[model samples]
Target: MGDILIVDDERDIRELVADILEDEGYTCRKAANSGECMAEVEKEPPSLMILDIWLKDSDMDGIDILKIAKRDYPGMPVIIISGHGNIEIAVAAIKQGAYDYIEKPFNIDQLMVVIGRAMETSRLRRENVELRRRDVEPPELIGNSPAFRTLKSSLEKVTKSNGRVMLTGPAGSGKELAARYIHANSGRAEHPFVTVGAAAIEPERMEEVLFGRESPERGIEPGLLEQADNGVLFFDEVADMPLGTQSKILRVLVDQTFTRVGGTEKVRVDIRVISSTNRDLTQLAADGIFRQELFHRLAVVPIDVPSLDDRREDIPELASFFLQMFNRQQGLPLRTLSEEATTLLQTTIWPGNIRQLKNMMERVLILSGGKGEIAAAELPGPDAAPADDQGRVVLSGSLATLPLREARELFEREYLLTQINRFGGNISRTASFVGMERSALHRKLKSLGVVTSSKQGARIAHLDEQPAG
Candidate 1:
């Protein structure tokens, strides 16, 4: 049992949790609203704080309170209780410093489980944060491989000019990070930098978000490319852009001018386009999937982001950085990974690459029992818990006995394909189910050349002759 604070405008909710935790042998404090929440924390901060995002008449929303508490008491763990919104806000909350969030009308057991995990995670983050540093430097291309060195030399040459640049890489290979480095290394580091992951957005309003548009429907304004004038317009997963948006982008790439959506007047902006994707744009063009002209315009100097497997040497540095990040975030006793854990970390095939590794570290930081060191069991399994599908099963096995990286890749390819089959190849459903955007998934399919069931003919014929990832 730990000291906890329950903050909500609803008396029933506050009372229910206060009563429950108290009965469970925890010292529980109740706050009828945010004012009381502020007052209560000031009185004596608890080990954990449970926050409800919305309330009947609270002075502050949960996100607001979360920011306050996170800033005021960086060590305090906050578990958000979202009533109306979904996990988008929850993920946003996490990015903004909330420990974790439970949906409204949560099962008591699940809430308790999340709470416990959040507390532990908070403790561990605080313990290991010193090992990691918030990335703020210009892209320092760090690799010794000849392939990487050639990439570095290419980057240097590109940074000398302001041409439309396109980058290619597998998912989680750090395209965006590389884009930023390009901006930072370029002469326009002082200008506004904007990024758009086209696949993450809905196709219906893609134009409005990208080019510029007036929408009475959403009371929205013009788009970002105009806003990023004199700077870079980074189109992430460019191959995922809708056909209409792709045409418009192609026009811009060619002429650096475009008529604002819903307007007749053509607007001109001095913007450098930096497009990145994991897909083969040429193949996409040939397959009638993307605009060939756009490919030629953006791919003037194409660069590839190296996968984590290719940079095994960077694992220790990256892990050290994450450990320190969790140390500050979790507030647990400072600890380091044992040699066994370190060895396991290096060998695992990161199908999801760096992004997966980061989440894995977070999971481990939370699951570890406050021990200074993290063990293999404490880490997240190879796969992320499928977000949109309940039946999704992570391909699991012994990490030590298997070739970690190759096994992970095999598992992911199969898992993603399985999800695709389950969703009947509805890319959006599959992407959401797998916690990515439709465009990203499209790019993945384009990059991997994964087969649909109809095309899997001979491969699916035997039932066991599936594509080896």
Candidate 2:
């Protein structure tokens, strides 16, 4: 739970709300005027705010404060309170992004219900942001190879410039990781780090998704640009963006402002754009598939992420890191890779790059039953193969000697992996094949330390072909 900010000119009403909220186990702050409100907001942002629309004796009205608050903290949920009970004013407050409106002489029960719902919305929104961060942001840049070192050096310079960066690399080649590293080192590290997958968004709703909409039914909704104000906005697979959306994004970079769909109010954002693509943007611009001016704008600082094949020296260390990470995440016993296993890992070409390596390591840990040592035979082929028709695992090393419990767990893990690979890493299809709900299968995979990315052709650990018994 987070603290609540209550803004009202009436001291008694403020105190009453504060007491009620405090009794409900919420920390409440009182603001009598716009000055106090802004000062409190600057000191520390509240999770949800309650503002009285008719603030008598205040230099700035409630609507003015609401506008400023929404502009500064677009994600914060706000509830407007008014003594007059004017519907028009309430509608206006919603237009300014209020979560809900309450008339004065309000029922306390209703107020509490609204407050609960608003706080939950705020909590969920924050959780969504955190999940996005976890999904895209790497724990750290995990390599000391020569190629990695050179890329890190270039990133250090780019971080300081705050110019639009264009990261080009193959699929799963750590472009997003590099973008995150830049954001982590830059001045905007404390602020939001938002990632938008340009290729994932529907082309028809691209404008509405990026710039938001001012709908008569849904009120004013802030877009990704406003959500990422004063922070880094990462555009992943940016070359796939529609031409019209590219032009709008270009306009934002050039003018530092954009009008929402069906809106005249230009929203100004102090954002640092970092765009990445696996495709050749230069060639796309040449083909007129992408806007030429947008490419030039985004490519002000171009970086090429090295493929895993080029950075094989980092393989052992990356393998160790993922081993430790999944061990902690899954509460599995710590396991170390043998010298032979490390050598084998380095020899392979990772076409899917770092992500493939990560997924493979996780799969190995789950299937190995947290055995003390990871031998070379426990790992799948460098280019992981598909499971055979009967879905039987090819036992290597000494699985027969393991304890019954560990052996069963390992067998179940292999079965799931085989099913997932059978479906081409499609969780829904895999769930159907396994006779389990999709979400339940996902939880099972997650619990077993299996990691699958939504990217096309992401690697899934599979068993080698074997003759039938």
Number of the top TM-score candidate: 2
Q: After superposition, how far is residue 159 of candidate 2 from its true place, in Å?
A: 1.4
Each prediction's TM-score versus the true structure:
0.52, 0.57
Tens-digit lDDT track for model 1 on 277-396? Answer: 988788899998998887888888888777776655466667777777677877744567876777567656688887888777776767665667777556654444433367665444
Q: How accurate is candidate 2 locally (lDDT)?
A: 0.81
Residue 297 C-alpha lDDT in model 1: 82
Q: What are the root-mean-square deviations of the candidates from the true structure over C-alphas? A: 17.3, 14.8
Q: lDDT, candidate 1, residue 358?
A: 74
Model 2 lDDT-worst window of ten: 457-466
Report clashes for each candidate as comma-separated counts: 32, 0
CA lDDT, every model vs. true structure: 0.71, 0.81
